[model samples]
Target: MSCQHAPSSDGNPTEADSLVIKVVETSAAGKQLSELTKFTASGADVVEITIKPNETYQTITGFGGSFTEASAYLLNQLSPDNRQRILEAYFGDAGARYSLTRTHINS
Candidate 1:
């Protein structure tokens, strides 16, 4: 995912801004997909997707998951080595790469 934001001429962020976002798909075939279409005054049914890597409209903070009491209990029951493996599986770069997480209070 990519986003692009246009800044105001006065060097200040304004409520009225221009933003364009595009989705980048990863595939084993190494295929890149992007399309551009112009809309007519009468309106068109066709839809087009445009990809611009240099353009960014939004910033992603993080990806995360929640931890439940049941899950926590199960995890704590595991051995230290097993616990390390589970943590790495979720937070590791080769895994889901979860950057944010939450645990319910008193759960």
Candidate 2:
């Protein structure tokens, strides 16, 4: 995954500020929350976005993952040591850091 935060230019700040955007990308090829350095646009590569931070649209209570029977089975297939390593890699401070979970699995 990749993230790009548009420059903030709020000389005269207000609820209506510049429409900043951050883009993150992830790929099965192994990318995980990787940020993009630049964007090479085509002749007509254009889009529109509106940012309204003050608006009350939806609220995100939390973020988390699900545990299924199949997942449990696969996890049990691994040795205890290997399983611990995988757990840490996904929920440890040095890793992805999820919610109650720490995670960067796709940060």
Candidate 3:
């Protein structure tokens, strides 16, 4: 489904959200296995796996690579255990990363 772009209270068009995913599979069997596992796992009430693709261009435009780089830098500054946990939670096997695009006006 496509999200709508609307004006906020400040009379500016809101950000645009979209994603295009291309799953990487080594073989046909692997593809089948991945799809099957994902479908079957969804039967449970809780979430099992969540993957979100990043829009490199849009993201770089919104927040420069330095921002993300700095974030990783800060995370690296944490203790080994804490960094591991934070990295796991943020860029774990099952996490979603979203990209937002919009234009802001300066008053």
Best by lDDT: 1
Each prediction's TM-score versus the true structure: 0.49, 0.50, 0.25
Q: In candidate 3, what are the lDDT values of residues 31-78, reduced to their tens digit? A: 442322222222457432232343243434332122355565687799
Q: Give the alpha carbon lDDT tens digit for every residue of 27-101 in model 2.
A: 898987676554543367656445567778888765557556667678889999999987787677887665553
* Clash number by candidate, in order: 5, 14, 0
Q: Any idea how many clashes model 2 has?
A: 14
User: Which parts of model 3 have CA positions greater than 4 angstroms off?
Assistant: 1-67, 94-107
- For all predictions, the C-alpha RMSD in Å is 9.8, 7.3, 17.3
User: lDDT at 105 for candidate 2?
Assistant: 48
Q: How close is candidate 3 to the true structure, as a TM-score?
A: 0.25
Worst 10 residues of 3 by lDDT: 33-42
The digit string of per-residue lDDT tens for model 1 on 1-107 reads 66676767965556576556566666677756643332332347534444466789999899989999999999999999999999999999888899999987797
**Model 2's TM-score against the true structure:** 0.50
